[model samples]
Target: MEEERLSQQLHEYALWKADVARNLGLYQNFLESQDNEDNELILRIEDIIESLSTDRIVIAFVAEFSRGKTELINAIFFADYKRRLLPSDVGRTTMCPTELLYDHVSKESYIRLLPIETRLEDTSIAEHKRNLDYWTTLPLQVESPDKMVEAFKEVVKVKRVSLEEAKRLGLFIEDMAQHLEQVPEYVEVPMWRHALISFPHPLLKGGLVILDTPGLNALGTEPELTVDMLPNAHAVIFVLGADTGVTKTDMDMWQEHVKVFSSGGKKGLLVALNKIDTMWDELENSETVASKIKGQCVSTAKTLGIDVATVFPISAHKGLLGKVKHEAALLERSGLPKLERVLSDEILPQKQRIVRDRVINGIGATIKMSRDSVKRNYDGTRQQLDELQSLDVKNNSMIAHLLQMTRKETIIYETRVENFQTSRALLMKHVKEMQEFLNITELDKHITAIRKQMEGSWTTGGMKKGMTQFFEQIRYNMTQVSYTASKANESMQSIYKRFHEDFGLVDIKPSILSMHHYDMRMDNLAKRAEEYRDSTAMTVSEQSFVIKKFFISIVSHARDIFAKAFQEVENWSKSSLVPIAVQLKDSKTALQRRIDNLQRIRDSKETVEGRIDELNQSLADFEARLKQLNEVCDAIHKPLSFDQPPAEAEDIKQQTAS
Candidate 1:
């Protein structure tokens, strides 16, 4: 029953994610129907929807050798397989950071392994996945579990490598060399860079991505997994053996990699003390066993400098057996229920909220802007219709009043045109200011300074600090460009209002400054910079070169982004005030028409009445559309709850408890 409940929670999460995607698609379709007038808004919403579509809740398991990471995964998610899904035996099993996901499009079960030699190529695993020729494929036979187990063992394949080769591959360190007084002829190295296992597993099929990371050696060698994959996962489960407590390697992993989340204020990191069943038989009293487990949790938490509440003592082996055999007592004593609760209740909800906020904040802003523009158009049309209805062509006093009003309106329109010229000059000045903010010369200087810091006397610690500062400067400048864009938006809006109020300009939509894109670009650059810093495989020289190359590419891309923004601003500034100029011309034509109509009032009365009726009809239609747009905007801004229905996420503690 507990297992079924967990499955139901996953199903609900899938439904919620689908709802988000559907609503975003609806909004994008509505924008597209507007004939691409709001290109900036439409493109941004499209990007958001695309991101949400591919988004999956990735849960990563990290630990040293024989900590039962794979077994834990099997117990929590893959127990329905009825046999060991991944090779988890006495010796080394998982040799690469294996990712398990369901590829629905493929609809076939297989494991694809990338050649270890591919690391020499300058491409990411994500890029490598796109090219099938680079991977070795092993198809799984669903009918035969024994054959599948044998096929899975291919992941642990290794070849002897000379010490020189190992050093060149960034696998050797001083500590290992010191222990090896006699340099061995060769050392066994993983044959694959990465292993991708795709099967129709229940949890995986429900938009869940599981990253089963290998031991320390594999993580130390694979910079991409250490720096990018693990950090970006929705949740990271750091497993430690309860019998051994926190070893030196576990502490190193915590401080060097897992602790990096502290800076981001992320709460998805959890510590699991596995193999607790080993302590079960050490004492006879049930209370004594409970005290010992609590002691281990506290000791492990203190050693790792994490909250004791975040640590869970679990026996994955026992838990797997208990779930498979329906032994509720064994499953309860194994302590897997608490961990699963944290996963379904805590981590999943956080992911949902993050995705929900991103969609609502981005799409809601665009909808509000469009709605406001439409409302302004509606109000302007109504005012025009009212003025036309009030015009009395028979009264001479009314003729005088209309003539005087036309002159006043014309003067105000002419004055607005003059003010727009001044605003255009100011707009040019701001454009130059924004361009200066993104100047590459200053960025190059920053890069040169960082290069010097690394090339000179430097420790790894100092180099890390220098890299952080370098990226900080990059972000600072990028932020300045975004800030200036906002100012430009304000300037354009002021002009929009003057034209609308003084010159009777209507239907002028907000110009697309795209400041949000700038913010997103900066965030991506920061994430990449942090990833590069976390890398453990690269040599000091290699790290330096990689950092420099990354920055250079970012600067180049920054130049292109800023250049496009500048061009758009220039184009928008040129045309933003044209409505006022056009209005002035119309006013002059209307003044001449009024003067002639006074002499032929009898003849022109019917034509004037027809014009008034047309204005009234247009105004009525505009108001109706404006009201519909307002309702759409209201629905978007309405607050949404991210939690699942409590009954569906029902507590399974009683069934799984000891």
Candidate 2:
């Protein structure tokens, strides 16, 4: 029943995304029909449509070894097979970080594995994903569940390697070695570093992605998982063992990795207390067992410094069994239904809200500008028609007088155009200055210099100092960019105001370039760097490995932030002066047309009634085009139905306790 609910919700989400894309396509068509010259706006809309078409909702499962994380995933997503799909039993099943998704482009089912030896290189997992040569591929026969299971077992494969090789891979630590009974010549390690499984499941085809991660050791060795993949997931489920009730290693993983999401008020950070059947006793009554589980839930929540409402107690083992056997009572006793409901209720709506916000912020202003332009043209055409109808055709002197007045008006408009060009040149100078502050090439040079300094350092203190200086320099550069953006915004506003005062053009507010978000991101990166410098993991890892991981994870993230800022500035430069420029050109063309009509009438070459008939036809065309523009704007802003009924409080209390 819970699986059905999740699948239905995913289906609905996919439909909502399609609806949005269809409307955007209509808007694109409208622009092309009107011969809209704002190519940047059209390109942005196309990008948004492409993003909606290929977007994936990622959910990451995080846990230490023997925590039932894999079993829970099987119970929730793979129960339609009526059996366990992935290799999940006893001590350690998923030896590497595995990603389960559908390959829509290829439309094929397969498993791709990256060799553990890739850790010796400086390339990140994300980079390795783009190159097919680095991974081994195997075909998946979805028709037979047994064959699929046999192929999936390869994710759990391991090999024994020399101690030196293990240490070089950053998989062996002194703290773990001290727990061994005696020094060994070899250590056991996973053969694969990462796994990618593309299957044709209903939910996967609907854009659902599952990331099943390994224990703390693997997470520590692969810095990219902690720094990029997990943080970017739409939701994170941190699983814990009910019998052990949050061990030391579990607490370490929570504090180092998962706590950041919850502390920052990010939604969809859920705690699944798995293996609850261990607490079920036949000697005691059901009520007594329930009370004990409730106490454990309260205790775990307090220890973790999280809300008890966010903690879910469930038995993944029994859930899977009951699902396969088709027993409703057993599935209800497992307490898996409630967790699934909350996940579906929370994640889908949140994802929709994010997409909606992006659409509104990205192209909402451009649509409005297009509508305004259409209305202005319609109004101007009507005024010209009224003026021509009010004229007397038999009086040549009157026509001659009107022609002289129009010629003088044309000259005045020409003077204004010259002034506009001068102001535009000044605005371009300020734009150039802003671009210099955000140049990506200049930022890369700074990064290269800092990396070299850290590489040459002989002591840990020197390396730490180098990292601190790197952030300080980045912050300084950001401050300069922020100041320049403010100055440019002020200049743009002044230009718009002058046009409104001089001519009758509407006073449109130009787009402002805000740097608050980028500033906050840089500050967060600095905090992460500070924490890494003081971490025990850094102290135990080799010096070379430490430098490489720091640059790959932390520095690379900072570079991404700067690159986005640079792109935004470039977009602002293109779009800031568009509305006024378009209006000026339209007004100039209308004046020239009016002057030509009066000149023809004064020369006795055309009748006044004939000119009037042509103006009336042109006015009708403008009205039709204006109506079409309004309809396109309305479609783009239409609201989607993303409402989901809230779960009852009584249901939450029972499920949280169970």
Candidate 3:
């Protein structure tokens, strides 16, 4: 029953993520339809849409060897493999850090391994991620678990090497080398740098990523893992053996790799005290064992600088066995339920909240601004129609009023056209400035200068810092572009205000003139620029080729981003007031018709009615589009809910039978 409940929880989470992705697609479609020319906004929306579609909930398992981290992962997510998915025997099973995720694109199961020799180069893992040719791929026999198990053993395969060679590959530390001086060959190292597994498990298919990292040595050697991957994970579950308590290596791992995530005592970290079944033999009763485990949790929490509640006591072996056998009592005793609840209820929702906030801030804000601007235009037009509706054709005063208003509106139109030209020039000026801002010539020069400053020490760490500096400069350029955009928007709004406030002309503020829309786009731009940091999380040792690739890729990406943004600004500056200008032209035509009909008021009543009908049709078209804009806006703000899935008829029958 507990297993079924847990399965239901995972199913609902998957459904919710899928629904979110669906809604994101709808938003992308709406944005594309409206602003096909505005590439910046489209690109921003596309990025968000892509992120939503491929969103993965990464749960990193951090622990020393023999702590049953791999076993716990199997119990929680991979029992459906019907056996251990990872090699988790009595000895160290996971020697290389392995990432298990479903590759929905290929729809095939395989493992990709990076050769350990690559670590001798200066390329970061982030760079290697772009080139699949660098990794060795092994196909899994999905039809037979035994064959799959056999293939999986490659993750733990090791090769013996001389101490000097081992040290060169970052496998041997001086302290360990000193202790191993008596041994001729001091190192037995894993053949792979990293292992990437793609399997068709339901949870993994639902975008659950499992990172099973090797113990202290691997974490210590992999700077990118500590700096980027682990820090960026949604949650890090540090598994500890209950009998061993918090060992020295575990504390070191906690302080160096895990504690950073929980610096401010954040909720994205959890500690699992595994192998609690061992405690049962020492304690007299079940209650006593539970008490002893709780005591261990407290002691371990204090040692790890976390709260006792964060330390969960569980037996992965028992949990997997109990869950497999459908024994509720054993599953309950395993303490897996409490940990699973925390994940489903707290951690998953937190991830959802972060994604929701981004969508609301970026897409939702843009839609609201667009909808409101359209609504304002529609309301103003409807008011003019209403005034025309009530005016009597026989009234000479009405004709005079209409003529005077039309003349003023004509002046407003002329002034707006002139202001638009000025805004266009200003936009062009900013676009040129932005083009310069994103130009890689200066960036390349700066990078060259930094490389010179490094004096050929251009080691991985040196270049990594250089990359960080490079991204910072890119961020600065993006900031300048945003400031220029904001300035242009301010000019547009000022021009709009003169028409409405001074000339008493109809409100002509275009959606493009609205700062809210630009602000949202700029915010998204800044976010994408910030994400470049994540992309740079390449391990320093990959090779200098990675730096060149990263530089070109980043420059090209920047050009696209800024080019799209500048084009949007140009488009807005040129065409923002066009809607109001057209309306003004129509207003003038209507007034001219009214004036011509003034001499023959009673006779030209039919013509006046025709003009009114035209106005009504125009208003109707605007209102319909306005309705669509509002619907899209509503969808953006709508809160997502994942109500429980309805029970199947067979399940209900089985329950009744039981």
Runs with alpha carbons beyond 4 Å of true place in candidate 3: 1-39, 181-183, 393-401, 413-445, 452-606, 618-620, 642-658
C-alpha local distance difference test of each model = 0.69, 0.82, 0.68
C-alpha TM-scores of all predictions: 0.75, 0.92, 0.76
User: Model 3, residue 148: displacement in angstroms?
Assistant: 2.4
Q: What does candidate 2's lDDT look like per residue over 1-658, in tens digits? A: 8788778778776776776687678778777776545677789889999998889899999999889889999998999898899988778778999999998887889999999999888777888888888999999999999999999999889999998898788777777668889867898889999999999999999899999988755666677777788878988999999999999888878877777765457888999999999999999999999999999999999989999998999999999999999999889999899898887878866886788778877777777777787787778778888887888877888878888888888898888889878888887787787677777788789888987887788477777887888888889888988998888888788888888887866768888889888998888777766765565554344655755675667877888888888878877877777788778878876888888788888787888788889888878987887786676566556554434234453342233233
C-alpha positional error of residue 216 in candidate 1 after TM-score superposition, expressed in Å: 2.2
Best prediction by lDDT? 2
Candidate ranking (lDDT, best to worst): 2, 1, 3
Question: Can you list the residue pairs that collide in candidate 3?
Answer: 121-541, 122-541, 122-542, 122-543, 123-541, 123-542, 123-543, 124-538, 124-539, 125-539
**Residue pairs of candidate 1 with colliding backbone atoms:** none
